[model samples]
Target: MTKENMEEGVNQKNVESTQMKEEKKIDEEDTKEAEKVNLTKVTTFEELLEVVGTRGKWNVLTFLMCILVAFTSPLQTLSYQFLGATPDHWCQVTPLLEANWTHQQILDLAIPFSNSTGRPENCYMRDYDYTAAAALGYQTTMKDPSAVLRNSSSLIQCSVREFNLSQYISTVVTEWDLVCERRVLYSTTQAVMQGGKLFGFVLFAYLVDALGRRPVVLVCSAISIIAGFLAAASPNIEFYIVLKFIIAAVDAGQYLGIFVFVMETCASKYRAGAGTLIVIPWAVGYMVVPGIAYVIRPWKLLQVAYTVPALYTIIYFWLLPESPRWLIDQGRYQEAFKVISWVAKVNRKPLPADQVVLAAMENIYHQKAQGKEADSATKTFTSRLLNLLKQLLSLLLISELRVRTIIVFFCWFSASMVYYGIALNATNLSTDPYLYIFLGGLLEVPSYLLLWPALIYIGRKKSLVALYLFCGLCIFSVMGLMLTYPGEAEVAKVFFSQIGKMAVTAAFQLAWMYTAELFPTKFRSLAVGQASFCARIGSTSSPYINDLLGPYTVWAPSALFGSVSLVSAALAVLLPETRHCDLPESNDFFTKTKEAGAEGREQGVVDQDEGVLNPSFVSEAGETGSQIHPRKSDTH
Candidate 1:
């Protein structure tokens, strides 16, 4: 062995060890710096609320906006009755029979009895010339038209109609003479409008996410105002129906845009309350509808009345502000800061003076600054669309989220089906449809009032389950009453039916807010829009279910609605309870935030990191759901 070689090797080993020590020291410093950054991140909505100040001037403005905007939706939607009411109609009796016989005698002598209704048929009449019969001194006594005709060939159908509108001043049915074969067209008019609503929910959802909430809302409001007025002046049924469809298309944006705006604007503590409260105006509008219809009594004038109120929405352009959270999410920090500053000024609150940003906010800002968002932003429309497709596919593709998504979708579907089913079919009840509708609207107030407390205490999942179960029970009771009493117990049937409607309305509102809370912010709008899209499907088909099944068996639609409600309630149990829980900001919410906290605590990660809590711990320790402790710089 050479002594010189051994010494050289030992020196080389020491040099290598020293180099490794220096690198390890540098890495530890970087880790500490990273931990410092984490300590400053804005992790939850509650922390954001701290910066914005909850329940201040900004909340009041957005709250008022929510109510005012929500009012326009139901008015535009349910105004069809006033615009298309079909008054009692009958065939025009020839002058020969008109002179000799009274109107009743003429109808009895000419029109056939309807097999389904046992009333005088509206279209067919005896073809024999009454003038010759009158000249021959034929009696003006009443007889069944079919009996007098003696053969099918002797009967004719009247093309024009005389409408007996003792109850109504005017209607589209009489103005256009849409009767007999055209009777079904009125329902089709309503159906087509619902179809338009179905499409609009999806369209506005995309626009809301792609564009911005404020602009889309204003654009839709303007369209609604214009379409509503044009519809009022529509010269014919076709024109009227087309305009109605346009109104329906724009109607969703007014409702959903404002709804999402309010949900996004309010602090976590007030989110549920805000969601339920916005529907009060809708209930008011629902109740107000029948009164307006009663007062106007003329279709065109009623249309005009419905159109006028929506004009106030234009003022929203000035009143409303872009959602700051959404802006920050989209990498538009300057705009977000501007909105926050405006809100601060209006709210009389001061912003954090230092250039310090929340750790979460900083991370997002850094990513955007590093061109993570820019590269995607620069991608073509096709690429963006494909990305959207990929995102949607992920909803069903991920096992954990897939179940929640599917169940929530069903909840939305059933909630919508029962809601619109009872709402639209209220016309067929024993009571005057106007009064019935008013009562239905009145019931919704208490329903929502009850929802606020129930959601806060009992929790969203349980409250929904209970509400849906109660709705199903109410419907089932109505069906039982109908079956037991058959054509008799009208009072009991109507009362229970209204109760069912109230429950369904509450369920619908819950589904809206709960579904929003279920998904992450990344695709919340798209998820809600998809849920609403399913809802529209249920709403669109409700009429057909009622009409088609109603004739075969009076209990069919009610049974169907009740059955679905019950199933949905059961499905709700499988969904993760989100009430009072932190809303996930990212797609890996349950894992990265919640599970990470648990894992970090187990692995002593929090202890090693000098007691800076993980995201979930931060959320739990803050004011309310998803709130996080603020950094020193944020105290200002």
Candidate 2:
């Protein structure tokens, strides 16, 4: 070994050692930078969720507020069944004749009894002068004793003079002369209210976005109470109908506003399941309506009774908290922090020290500042409304979302139509209407209970598809029984119909969950509002559709509802399975071509540490490709 060769070897070893040391120092610096990035990037509200215990005092309080607010929906909507109830009615006998004749004799003389049903035909009456007949010597007998009727006397529809409502103590149907030729008007009133609801949903969504959710509910509750009280004292059917529309419009806002607030405030882990349970109060409300109606019986008093509860909900204004998400979205960080602090205190959770929380909030403020900004120029109400509409329409032009949006809209429409159609028809049954409605509402509880586990286990798409098809089949079977056995199958028909109602109830809940999962955050509220609008349209038409087709044949509307549902079940198959999948956050996150292939993949991993990923987690790497995945909040 020469001296030069040994020196060369040592120099190379020294150089290698220096390079290794430099690399180690660089690696340590990178590690520290990564830690800093994570500490500052508090992208999701879920991180602070633990500090305010997930299910504790805050959640319990929120649940009560949500349930209380929801009770008005079924009360206002279904109370019409009792308010507009029609008992056996006939044409009013003139006062001149009634002075001498008994009630049975007056009815026997004026109304033409059907040999088939042994009851007077509701519309037709003998065109004889009952007053003149009584003036001369007349007495109604078991046989056709009237000389005018003994000869072939023609029948005529009742004039607008008056209606006999002796059988009914009181009902809007008889009071408004909404029987015989005007029977269709009774159903029309319900449809009009539903139309009002459709408009209200669109209007209130904007109000909620511009204002806060809490204030909108408070204002709506006040409006509903006033409208309802006035409606009970309506001078005529037209006035009552208009008031119903107004009450329905205001109540619709209350229903959805509280729903959004509840979803936003609930813990992320429990959100998907919690939404299913929210309908429990709505079901209970329906159940209570029948009992109230049975006790009150009269239409005017029943309406007043239903309206009184809205006054009770007014107290919730103090109890309900403004949604924390809305506060943060509006750049009110201090208010949001205060709410979080309150939640933590009520839950008895160990929150970080004041400095720690303040530091974390500071990070949140900075992150929000760096993110997207609402345009200052577009701050006006009109501009915001236009912007919201534009964003909603943009969803149609988006890639993968376009198909999903349309499909979900149809599913929502079908679900709502079938649900309300069945509900309204149950009132027309020959059996006890109140008991029937109560039983129907009772079934809703088990449906939601069954849906919870199904959503968690069998997955969303399969569960929805199964529910749609099962309900559709049950509905069609009821139609068949009405055609096949007609008389003997009454009990079986009702049983299957209730089953169908239960199935559709589950499908309706699943539809909301499925649609919410499909849209990105930017258009989530708009998308949901649009879907609800579509649903309202279907529900609006439901009463008239049932009524119009019912006279022709019960099977017509039944087949129509069943076929649409079956088609919806087929459509559900086309939707990408979203079980455990992250919700999308932006329009750009979706691919140009739809990925039906993705549905075949495992439901995807739910990272407890990071929270659920956006639906487009794998495709759009732009916003999501940063250090951490975006946290999927149920509010969006």
Candidate 3:
């Protein structure tokens, strides 16, 4: 054994050891890859269907429940539409009568008139006479022979000196303006009605999340029914407005509860589609409003049209079950199991009882692990409030969540401006105002149908941005046409504006789905409520902006909203695409940043964090072993 032979022998042993080690590592990797494939194969659509079939009866009931809940949006919006015309007709008749009165005199006259006649005080005519004194260029002091003849020649001749008949006639005219004018009463009533909508939005979100969807919605339906009847029976503007406001508030509850309920019931795979489906009712409600207003004619009659839907909603209470997902979240495992079992039975296949129990146990364990308890005390006033605040802050901070929220808010704001603007300006367009409004609303149906498919296929960011941009472009184009052509192309302008309204309505529907998909399950309702709250602010501001800018001064709100949407679209580019990604557990931006770099090993260090390394580009010194092992390397 020479020194050279011994060295060669040692080298051979080391080579064999290295080769064997490599083979073992390859075998281990293959085993892990096989296990991953097996795990992926465990769940299938057929098995899911089988489980669903075993509880077929319950599934049908749950499906119907979701549909019923989804129906509330249309019901509430349509009801508002039906009752909407009272103010419109009244606004038309006011200014003709109050021609020469001071504001103080009008106010003084309106208070007594409102009390005695049961109308709103604000509905009194403004100080403008369009027909006689102003339009014909006649002064109050000029007494024409024809006016004298119309009043009575004998009285006219006697009143010139003795009777002071002109003074009496002036008092009569002023009284008539205050007491008998529909516009004066309608204005006051509309204010109250609008205030009710504001209160409704704020309160309904809290109530629905607290009380559970079924009970709250049933209560809402009942309130709406009673309010509808009260509105129909009212003999005066005060009662009508008061009742209308109550109706609007309850309708808000219906809107909030139904959407939450339906979305909760749907499977994760179809949740976005189901959420989007809820908005279709709003479009339908909008379309139905004008037609019902036309058919009903008088405001009182329209109240009856609104009440009919309330009756249907009341009946729906009996047909629909409570949302099982909500029940599960509340830690009512027995109820969840019963509902799931029923779903399986309805699908006409047996559920694996042990698996069902195991799933329930796992859910309970997770809930406990998260420090959540079934007791109501655990969801106390302070705790729930804190949780809500935390959720709101999280939504605001998370880039993806913030982007979706902003887009939804702007879209909602724009849609509300255009939708309500069109409805308000219907009288300016044609004699058959309701028909035009109805037609505009009817166009949203196809748009709604097209929305979900586009979202699923094209992805959320593109669909939302595209819809928003299209809507903004439509509005801007309509504004351009209105400004440049004016009366010459009045009909064309109206048609174009209506098209913009429809496009915005579609965008609004899609945005709701997009917002829902951006947030996790735990904060789903809270995120929705906050976004909706921002939207309500937009809606609340629309009327004031319209009044300030004038409906024809379309550029103010149109440009403002369009700019908002454009900015949101740009910000949407910053959001990570969520169409295929699982909803994140926490909104930790750094976690997402780190995960972003996980795909490519050649990428540089994303941050100064431990366990992170830049493998591709290193210092020109001798390479370290740690740098080659990215998983084990520490950059910090």
Which candidate, 1 or 3, has the higher TM-score?
1
RMSD of each: 16.4, 14.4, 18.5
Quick one: RMSD of model 3? 18.5
TM-score each candidate. 0.83, 0.82, 0.66
Q: Write the per-residue lDDT of candidate 3 for residues 1-636, one digit (tens) a residue.
A: 999999999999999999999999976775454333221221212223333442245544555554543443443443432344322112232232346543333333222234533543333332232344333323431344243122332211110111122322222112223222333443334334445655675577666655677787788878888887776677555666678678777776676667766655554456556656666655677677666665555545555665676566766577655655566556566766676556654554444444544364344335323522333444578898877665447656765456556655555555555555544454333335566667766777777778777766666667666766676676676567656865456677567667766666666666566555555554566666666665655565554554445434545655665566566556555444445332322233233445546754343223221222222112336343123322312111
Badly placed stretches (over 4 Å) of model 1 are 1-39, 93-102, 114-118, 126-159, 357-361, 364-385, 391-394, 593-636
**What local lDDT does model 1 show for residue 121?**
74
As a whole number from 0 to 100, the lDDT of residue 274 in candidate 2 is 79
Kindly list the per-residue Cα lDDT of model 2 for residues 162-185, writing each as its tens digit: 444554578888678887678788
Residue 69 CA error for candidate 1 (Å)?
1.1
Residue-level error in angstroms, candidate 2, position 417 = 0.8
Residues forming the 10-long window of minimal summed lDDT in candidate 3: 154-163
The residue ranges of model 2 lying beyond 4 angstroms of the native Cα positions read 1-39, 95-99, 115-118, 140-153, 160-167, 352-388, 427-429, 582-585, 588-636
The global C-alpha lDDT for each of the candidates, from Candidate 1 onward, is 0.73, 0.73, 0.52
In terms of lDDT, which candidate is stronger, 2 or 3?
2
